[model samples]
Target: MSYSVHVLHNGYSYLKDGVMRANCTCTLIKGPNLVIVDTMTAWDKDVLLEGLAKENTSCADVKYAVGTHGHSDHLGNLNLFTAATHIVGYSVSYKDEFFIHPFETGEPYKIDDSLQVIPTPGHTTEDVSVVVKTAHQGTVVVAGDLFEREEDISDPSLWRYIAGSENPDKQQKYRNEVILLADHIVPGHGPMFKVTEDMKDVARRDQLTQK
Candidate 1:
């Protein structure tokens, strides 16, 4: 089964009143089932919902709401999708009938034939990236902080902002694995881009450097 992936936001960080505010990229997968990858920040709830409305989709239509990690920016608005199944790496409580599911690393949770949630822990111990088999793009990976942007693959320093990422070696390994697994990547905080051979080579070089 093939699906269509839509990027609701190309995340970025900027200063507002001398305070840093960031938004994580949010993506929606439309196929046999509707799936929302990330929910950006709490402040973006309105925009996110509006974007879905513009697409003729609503939170109630979402079958699954999967957060790439536990970061506030990525899972802040999860409660808004009360009609969808919430999947996360860590445990959380919700007052509604909505079920909160927990996923582990190395296991791919199949939402449908076209969508799979694969653990890509690096930014956080529970980070998971969603792999969607798209009709036009082949395999598209909604990588959370695994690859924040295209340059993050080659820049080790970019990992510095990853909260609780203590194992740099393991993190680099996961990064390489995600890049190899994705044909196109919707990074956690940047526009979607193709994962070409050149990008793979760069990731390889970065891996070697880390070793």
Candidate 2:
């Protein structure tokens, strides 16, 4: 089955009390069931709800809420999805009424025939990326901090620098794997962009450097 993915916020950032608050990219996947990938910060709760309302969906309609990792900006509004199943890494802890399932590496959670949640683990040890097969876009990946932006592919070292990755080598390996597999990617804090041959070459070079 084909699915539609909507970007609620594409790398949105704002100033709050002189502090720059970055909002992670939040996506809503509409398929056999409603699934939300990475709910934005708590302050963006209204914005998230508004986006869902525009789609004729509310928090109640969401069946699953998946967090790429346990970051404030990524899982801040997680509690709002009280009716949906919350999926996160085993290390994450939350108090909610809904069921919370923790996923481990190498275990792919199939949301549907078109959507599969796979552990990408680059930006953080617990990171996961969602792979969606759309009718128009063959394989679209919802990458969390795995790729903050498209530039990360060209400058792969930036991910290690910015994320302060514990296992930089492993991160680069997983990132290269994702780059080779995904056709298009929705980054954690950037607009969706096509995965180009040039990007793949750059990623390959970065992978070689990690050896």
Candidate 3:
């Protein structure tokens, strides 16, 4: 399967749907710098490089390669961009032998002045989502494993894996943020969708009902 590169509203180019069920990487290009959101498997590294090179983006130009969490699939093949800076959440360091090298660092991506970290840790202790107001995308959430369009965020079954496992408190926090700040939901898996203004009220009502 051939992957198609699409430019997102945030002035980033993303790869969607090649193989392995749309595990994608989104790139933010500005001047000579690129910020790669996620890296796929080791086998797909060359393909990712080729695709980025075609768009005039490269690991050499990468300012940061962000792994949403410490999952092997998310950060394992990060060797492709040895030149790029690797960043992840504080909690990710707990994953055993997961750190191939000391190159990977940890930091939180700030949202607003008031809303800095959208700590959605149930997916993993390190699982955190980012909320940023982009010029074209308005308010959007790059919600790695925290939220997925493939399943309803409100689904109780979603809690089976993470509930009482680690940082279970974040499950409700994740749901609450989706209803408030998200104009668009950009998943690390599956398609991206906009949460309509009308839906905001419904989402809020859903939150209240769930409570």
How many clashes in each structure? 0, 0, 0
lDDT of 3: 0.52
lDDT of all predictions, in order shown? 0.78, 0.79, 0.52
Encode model 1's per-residue lDDT on 1-211: one tens digit a residue.
5698999878875457977667888888888889888898878888898889877999889888888888889988888788777777544334444444545537677777778888777677778888898879979999887776776666656655532365566677887877777899998888899999987887788778878
Name model 2 segments beyond 4 Å from true. 12-20, 90-105, 204-211
Better of 1 and 3 by lDDT: 1
- Cα lDDT tens digits for candidate 2, 74-105: 98898888777777743333344433345554
* Predicted model with the maximum lDDT: 2
Worst 10 residues of 1 by lDDT: 91-100
Candidate 2 yields a Cα-based lDDT of 0.79
What are the per-model C-alpha RMSD values against the true structure? 3.0, 3.3, 8.2
Error of 3 at 132 (Å): 3.2
In candidate 3, stretches whose alpha carbon ends up further than 4 angstroms from where it belongs are 1-33, 91-118, 154-169, 206-211
